[model samples]
Target: MSILPELERRFRRALAPVEEDPDPLLAMIRRSQDPKFGDYQANFAMALGKKLGRDPRQLAAEVAGRLSVDGFCQPPEVAGPGFINLRVRDDWIVDQLTAAIGDERLGVPAAAEPKTYVVDFSAPNVAKPMHVGHIRSTSIGDALARTLRFAGHRVVTDNHIGDWGTQFGMIIYGYRNFCDGEAYGQNPVGELSRLYQLVRRLIDYHAGKTRLAPLAEKLAGLESRLAEMHAEAAAEGKTGDKRVKKAIHRQQKDIDEAREELGELRAKLEAVEQDPELSKLAAEHPRIGQSVLGETSRLHAGDEENRRLWREFLPPCLAALGATYKRLGVAFDHTLGESFYHQRLRPIVEELIAAGIARESDGAVGIFFEGQDAPMLIRKKDGAFLYATTDLATLRYRVEAWQPDAILYVVDFRQSLHFENLFAAARRMGYERLELKHVSFGTVLGEDGRPFKTREGDAVGLESLLDEAVARARKIVEENDDAKPGGAELSPSQRARIAETVGIAALKYADLSQNRDSDYVFSYDKMLAMNGNTATYMQYAYARVRSIFAKGGVDAEALRASRPPIFLNTPAERDLALELLRFGEAVDYCLKDYRPNQLTSYLFELANCYSTFFENCPVLKAETPELRQSRLVLCDLTARTIQKGLGLLGIDVVEKM
Candidate 1:
């Protein structure tokens, strides 16, 4: 067992008999800011003074006199501000460190009452390549899973993929109208690309005139009036009238409001820009745009043509998504998409209706959650199930099948409202047994601090970015290591494989090391840097330690071949040992906070300590034989710590630079 539980028990027992509030005493152990003050400190005397009606120092002395701690920590000493400074005996720290070294879990005990948690993350929609937007979810989700599993919890990671959506309607239309049979037959992703292009072309072909006839004329009049106002404001600016500035401001607002209606106008116009044929059709036959959009909508609303196209493209899209997941080392426990919840949607609606929790609003079935001004739409006015219906159905399934203690949704921040409503509605319907959490993170930004995009104006593909990283990693590996023993050079494929591992690890670690809730600027140079908190720095530390041991011919099988007693005489040695022993505590904290960056921060510090220890205490330069062997053991353990620590973060460390 860890020292925390023992300390906690003793603390509670000490406070149990006292008639005053125990929360202060309970918080004292955690109040200690640093190790220099003592391993733990309690500032409860100050808290008790106001409550117990006594002087803070006198109260602390009274508590100290009454409290008893043995076989764990020394007698608590009353300090300034009635602080009780508690220090574990040196023998205790050594014993704990020794126990940790011998134990596989490093003296960290599994949860006394283990929980089964379901973490849903990295859900990219079917038919679209995984993009920069998906990186945070996948990376953060994996790190969370790793941290939780290490903490002895049963973790179930679900990839709640967006496989069912309106995009399929346009995809179907494109596949049927403009698909090249031979091209698709050869390459599925390429074929889907052509289909996506075709659908986009059709969208452009119909965009300019998709607005209602009356609305279009109104918009035209508004635009004309807006242009006239702008021109008038420009001409009036010459007179410098104060009212002209106010009129200009008011006119600008009106113009902006009008331009927003042209959102549909702009999207269609963009599509037209990409396809000459679509552009010509948009100009020559405005009604064709309306007819095409109607058809696309009809298909999305369960049109037979759209359904057929969705069926054809879905499997291929899933296949493509699977390939990306494999490349990124992410997987799911199940493959349940929106279509999987189709059967349950009707039952859910029935259950909600029976409970009187749902009502028909504007021809749509919805549930208006308490405290929420807006209602959650479960079904469209046309009696078709919406995303809300499927999500609710999925929630029910997870509850029935897995019965998770907590359900974590690692979705985009924009979908916070949807999840909030769904969670509230679930609670309202009496699913209080399950705790729901939203692990929402910000979007991935480009160098310019905007959303990442490709030159082709599409979301940057995961495959392309990963491939580039791997390629760069390979170049670095080759530059560092050329000869493969006996004057033979490393093969291209071998170099490529190593590079791939390093590159991907660098990319994944960069994201995992940052706070998941904040947007991070993705850059290769920063992530792959040989210094700082980057993966390369950690890997280099691991490699340096490994190199020292390898030169001494010390292998894993020979770790126990020699027994070297740990000597913590030097300050550097004591510091390194203390840092190494704190690994388990770091892991525990990460699990508690659901933050891998906590662990990352610890790992970085541990590596830094090891570096300083090696610099100050020269292992190879020791005078005595036993001293040399003892230092080697320390080196070996340090290497192992680096390996295990990085491994826990899902990052691989190479033995050489």
Candidate 2:
């Protein structure tokens, strides 16, 4: 029933004698990129001639003469440079359209070998409100998941929540310090948020103080020492044993410089110690404050209370994230946060130690990869675990649990290095079996060409943005009410439903229609416009077709009773039919690239073709019954195409206006 498949089969059978590879014949079936050329031009003859050392033009003529493809297409004709130009017959178009109307898959086949994929995305930290930055992961992740699912793959979405680490220490600290019992009892999140703010204020208050200045001085001293050592090593490598004395002198100089800096810090601290008021403040502040800071340190070491708090809060926060997923129509199979790999960390550390991949440097266990300038720190000098450790453990967990063919991380470009290191480490550990991909995206810019934000230039909350979309949609729908007969008289609930459909569709389409990795200006006016590539445009297309069916009083089942003879000899009819026939191919293309803009572009062109056909050709007013029914079927198929395409992108269609 598939026109392309039938064409391919016929092409293969016809060329079986002259051709050994089938790819050449298959490539000839695709439409020519340039319209100036024939509908489809095959260059396989030239390639084959080059291989066989035969005359190209004669080879093309021979292949064209042997083709028995008249049933679905015109006789092949040889053209410039030994290319076979194919012009499809009008009947083939008609037959294909009829079959597609009745077919659910629309003649597209599933992948022969489907692979299981794990997609990690939309991982927001608990106790932190979701912002505009989160949209890239949430939206892009959902689209990718949908595309993979449509491509016939079993995809598992995993939201790796930022539910553990130093933030918890601050939260626990600020909770005990600032919690208003009655207020906290009423709302846990609000109290948690208040605690976060209090901690932020505390950190800001002490960060610039003289007491904590020594730690910065110490880090600078260490860096200077390391830089000097590097220079000495370079000198030694260049001069060999002849300049060993020079290298030693350079090394001594670097050590002396670092020691001098440390001595200055010690002298300053000693001076401050002699002054009682300064001494008290220094004790209160210190180079670091709060012993609980040690808990974050031990978290990297896989400590118990830290582990327990992470386990207790991670699931609750994940549940909260699922609520957002419900709103956005995103779902995940299994969630593996930092805590999920709590048990695996020790073994991973032991493996690194045993295999000599990691060594204890300055009290920290770290692994220096083959080409990396910096080592992957598994544990800090204070024996604490970090994001890198959890990520490693999570990567191992996914590989072992799923044995997936592909592990896709739908994260921001900012985390590119993190994933690179993770992948490198996994590869080094013999996980060369899985496909690791990072689907990174750019920022969503504001009118000022920066990341999208509110009027105050702070992060815009997702819920508030969605609500504004609904409000704008309501106004646009109201303005266009006169276009519909009873649109104005509709009840508030009905009006609300229409607004919701238009609003959501606009929001989703606006985001999806842009390049996946490009920063886009978020404009309500642009997104909500009823014309162009906006969702409202597609919805309007569907509505127009529905209006025709309603006015004609012909049900879809009745219209499809027969193929209703179609004639595409006219340019407009041919163009519309051609665009209509491309629906399946366009969907397949979108799935291939994980880009919904492909589908949007096709829908827009289809609508434009419909508009052209509307002007030149009459449907209900056609001179004959056969032409009228055939046009009606075209209209019905268009509506279905728009509905199905938009549905795949998670957009809705309205019946009126």
Query: Scored by CA lDDT, what does every candidate get?
Result: 0.74, 0.74
lDDT of 2 by residue, 1-657 (tens): 444556677778767888788775576566667765656667777778888899889988997787787776778788888888777777888888878767765545666689999889888777566776787677767777776776678888888877665677666666655578787677666677667655653454344344446656665676676667667767668535546657656666766776665555555455556768556644564433354476556665667776675555555455666776677777778776665676777788878788876788878888787777888889877555767888888888888888899988877777788888888878888889888988777778887886786653358877677788889999878777745655465567877888987887788788888877787788878887767888888888788888888878888877777657666757888888878877767766776656667878888888888878878888889888878887888888888878877777777788876
Worst 10 residues of 1 by lDDT: 482-491
Alpha carbon lDDT of residue 207, candidate 2?
48
In model 1, where do residues sit more than 4 Å from their true spots? 1-3, 19-28, 31-35, 62-77, 208-271, 274-312, 478-494, 561-563
Clashes of 2: 4
TM values, all candidates: 0.85, 0.79
